[model samples]
Target: MPISGFPEWLPPQRMIEQFVLDKIRSTFELYGFAPLETRAVEPVETLLSKGETSKEIYLLRRLQEESATSDDQLGLHFDLTVPFARFVVENNGKLQFPFRRYQIQKVWRGERPQEGRYREFLQADIDVVNRDTLPFHFDTEMPLVIGDVFRSLPIPQAIIQVNNRKVCEGFYRGLGLPDTAQVLRTVDKLDKIGPDKVAAALVETAGATDAQAAACLKLAEISASDGSFVDRVRALGVTDPLLDEGLSELLQVVETAAEHAPGLVVAELKIARGLDYYTGTVYETQLRGYERFGSVCSGGRYETLASVGNTRFPGVGISIGVSRLLGILFGQNALTVSRSVPTCVVVAVPSEDKRSGCDRIATALRRRGIPTEVAPTAAKFGKQIQFADRRGIPYVWFPGSPDTVKDIRSGEQVEASAADWTPPAADLQPVVSAG
Candidate 1:
């Protein structure tokens, strides 16, 4: 029986995943981001620092150990950002200022099993961190990179919905609501619980007046694909320096994206990320036609998530939920690959005594960068060809007088050299594409 949330892909589907990951990795590197990886486990207290994700963390424990000790207090990280923060704090002196890096790793969460939700999944993240003062331009740059990534993929179009914490917090503070975090959290649930429940939560939990709740909802409803959102926000009659600062910052992000990656991003005021650490710009990505699956990617800017002494490492980043995105696509039969296995050529074994000769041919092909395997048994020629056919192997090389290779599908055999014969580039590897 397979575990519900821990997904395992078949060979074809795994090929699709590798295909997507390659595009993401190549695109990240093309933009000069170095690759990085961190340990899977972090101190329990460290994971708990994010506050909202404590319940979703999976703690690590040894079954053989009788009791726990202080050193054993650890848990699997639920997200990459928290671990990245600790990594920065520990390695601050060794790294350069304004470091850029990309990480693709499996992250564990204890959320209930559902479509597009998982207990274990892969996440790809790119981030730029600065020691003291990170540039605001990096915020805009995050979405542009993400836009390039999605555009390169075979999946449906991805629209990155962006918002800023300062916008939400400043607006709430302007309404005489000091507990901005509470109000932001409630508004973050607007998409899940709807506007009515969110309004009630704002008044009941955030201790906002009914009128203040209405204003908060109004602000949440404001969205635009361009700078027009700025004027709409101004019309709300909320005046505060922080609100003005946030509005200007968000406008820059929106306008920059419009100029570069047109139609790839939108200013969505309701996108208050649930994580409390996001102090500035926040992001959420929705796949067109898959809206019910929720945001397949999300992250934000955090000014104080990592620090050592007086040094603060501020960063802006986004993470793609690789598993969730693929899950949704796979459920819809939206992706496929040319073949299940990587093997491109199979050398037929004429007889048990001739297996050694076939092995040599296989070796020669492999040395030339062609994926090849010798027949498993000294079976009949028909049976040998059948074996290759069953595995989706395209070519069958026969080691004999004037060695010939057959394109099994076309039923065409041609004389060829094991040392130099090459299949078409498309047949060299499994070709992944939209179904």
Candidate 2:
């Protein structure tokens, strides 16, 4: 039996995964983001400092090694952001300012297996960081880059719900809430538990009064496709300088997205990303009808998290939950590959004497970039054709007078030459298509 949360895909499914990842990487590179990768294990204290996700971090150890060594203190990184922050700090002198990089890697979590949550999942993340200050324009560019990626992939349409942490922090402060972070965490549960339960938790857990909880619920309910969210928050009758700053920034985000990637972004007031690291714009992405599976991609802005020697590195980033997206897509049969094997044609060996000829044919086809396989045995023509059919190899080559090839699917045979024959472009590689 397979382990519950650790997914292992079949050959065809792995091909689909590669196709999606390639699209994401190309899109990131098109936007001038350099590729990067960090180590899987990080210091225990480094992982714990992220504030959230501490409980879900997986500690690393050797099965045969005895406990009590310093090595036991290291843990597998739960997300890409923490290790990246440490990377920036350690390589501060080498990296150029306004660094932009894209990372695609696997992350481990000790959380329970659920629809979208997993113990081992792959994340494709892109981030932009700069010394002291990161321009807000990068915030706008992030979604645009992701929009292109999602559009390029063969999956359901993704809706990117955006919110500003400043909006939540400022509004909480305006409501006289002492612990804005705690309240934001509680409010982040609004989706799992309804508004009423969230309000009750705010009062009982976060020390909010009934009136404050009600006001918080109202604010969470405010969402808009344009700048209307700004006016709606103002109508809430709460006034604070931080609130003004947040509203203005959020409005710019919505307006800029509308001008460029229309209908892709919306101002969602309740996207309190639960992580304490985000201090400005936060993002969560969901497939249109798969909201129940949770956000497949999420990230945000961390203004003061990457700082060393009084120089602060403010940055914004987003991570695509590659495993979660593929899990749901494969589960629902939303997509499929053309074949399980990559062989475009299988060379038939009439007898042991002609095996070398079959090998030469395969090698020639392979040299021309065609995926070809020689028959494992010098079997009968019918048996060799059956072998190719079983593996979904579309064509079978016979080295005979004029070198004939047969399309197994249609039973069509035609004279062909291995040195010059080329299959249709669609048949050159396995095709992945949405169901």
Candidate 3:
């Protein structure tokens, strides 16, 4: 019916959505973060290295004749992190350590589309990596930056749930479950497949007995504040070294983050990312009352996920589902821009004979960084004003008037200077309608 997985929008919607993404990228860049993008496809083998993540990849194929060799070497990227690791390795020598970069691009997943989960969607990601070790503080602060973007948009309160991979691994190993990675992938699907299916899969593939599966479920079910969750993980009688270390690290991060943005990060012990790649922290985000919309932001820490020669890169980061978030905002009427583009003032063209005069006035305003557009048609003055009104451009400029501009919104034409004309702050730029 509607291109099932790929979604597009009309002018106003696309405009508002782009406004959100622009702010995200801009905020990241403001922090001196560079931007980078990788090819959409990576070697199939690399994509499959993470079990359930591989399941989501939309594979690529040869278009030529059957004579083509079976390279079995390509697939669409499901996320930005893996390809980024490869990118750093491929250009290690030329790159700077503690590389800070942001990427805004499309990712593909061959999954059913319902609400926020689209088969193909755009993501805005930011990460900071180092040659060998990335500071743990990034785990706490990076989410705050992400939260800032959401706050700037002034949407509903968003909560960030964080957990540790080592904690999950240790807990699973304590339960006598072999292949903790496999178990993780299954548990990660708990919200989607429900406990019964996840338990069945775990028992079937993980040598987990019914009771063991229940125990794993109990672990998955155990999520709380830093102190409480750590206590629950300890009570499981799973004596593992990684368990204690992960617990301590998670506590430090949660405490550190709380110091900056109180009550923002939760120690959600169930956030087992299931990918062998994530070595430390993991994150999930949701709107306060719209948790069912799925995670609007997600990512984590990876240790040694990228290696080249004798060097490896370890880092932490997160991504916002820009398109998904905007779509949700639109559906709920939570955000919207009045027009697709900002037009500070539109110069009315009385007649084609007066076209050059209109161009001069529009140019004068535009040169000063004011977004100005000239009336395209030679029509009645009322018609010209309507054009600006329909586009939601606030003020209309008249070339021959002695510095007079009309507030299309208020219908008050005033004597204002083309050089110093200022619209009220709120009316200067169109706001995103909340719906």
Candidate 4:
């Protein structure tokens, strides 16, 4: 029986996925970000610290163990950020300050699956953490990096929506709401459930009056591609010191993005990244035409999210929802690779007696950086060609004095040397093409 949410791809699909990952990794490294990975399991308490995600965490237990009691219980990490926090705290002694690292790994979430949501998924994350104070420039840098990743890919354009927790919290306080956390949580669901329902929840669950709920919804509805959102927010008639700080930070982020990567960012007040730790700017990404599918990449600024004793580490980061992106792209047939397998050439044997000769030809081709495989059996020449055709192998080499290879698609056989012959650059490896 097939598991529902755990996706396993076939060869071609997996190849396309690897291709996307390579682009993301190279972009991160190009910007001087080092790579780091943490263990899969974290203490349950550590995972639960970020209250919003506790319900989605998958707990760990051994099947053979009878007793559930233990001093410490571990659970599969639902997201990379928590494990990253634990990693930074545990390795604080040896690491340098203002550490920048990129991690690409699988994270398990026990949430219900939908179009772009999955239980088991891969996330590509990049973060910059400082020992005490993190420079505000890192917040602007996060969207720039993500913009490069999306542009380098063969997918639709990704527009990053930016907001700040301080902005939301400060606004809530201005509305005379004592519990900003609950209001933020309810506002985060504005996209999942419409504004009317969110407004009701704000009044009922977050203890907001009808006027307060209406004000909150109005703030959430404001979004713009430039600094215009700052004025729009000011027009809302809410005032607080924290709100001013958040507005300034958000304006800087949007303006910096406009100068560095135009049309790649926007100030969206509704992007209240449900996680409680986000203190400054928050992010949510939406594809050009697939706005309803939700964020394919998102993260935020967490000041003091990772701390030990009196030492606090402030960081800014973002994550690419790898599996979710691929799922949407694959479902819509938006992308595809040129070939299924990596094999570019298949050597054919005339008869059973010549199998050894075909093997030799394949080996020589492989030495020249060509992907070649020999026919398993000395079947008919046509049958051998069919085998290559079935596997999307482009070329079929026939061993002989001259040693020529045929382009199966064109059926054009030409004399070539194994040492120097090369396929058209596009044919060498599977090229991911956007439809």
| Candidate 3, 327-376: lDDT as tens digits | 77777877767665588788888789989988887777777778888888
Better of 3 and 4 by TM-score: 4
> lDDT tens string, model 4, 214-236?
99999999989898988898999
Better of 3 and 4 by lDDT: 4
lDDT of all the models against the reference? 0.91, 0.90, 0.81, 0.91
Error of 2 at 353 (Å): 2.1
Candidate 3: which stretches are off by over 4 Å? 30-32, 50-56, 59-67, 401-403
Q: What TM-score fits each model? A: 0.96, 0.97, 0.91, 0.97
TM-score of 3: 0.91
RMSD of 3: 2.4
Worst 10 residues of 1 by lDDT: 65-74
For candidate 2, list the clashing residue pairs, or say none: none
Candidate 1 structure quality by residue, lDDT tens digits, 333-433: 99988877899998988888888888888888899999998888988889999998987889998888899999999999999998789999989998888
lDDT per residue for candidate 2 within 178-224, as digits (tens), equals 79989999999999999989999999988899999999999999989
Global lDDT of model 4: 0.91
Kindly report which residue pairs in candidate 1 clash with one another: none
Model 4 regions more than 4 Å off: 52-54
- Clash number for candidate 4: 0
Superior candidate under TM-score, 2 versus 3: 2
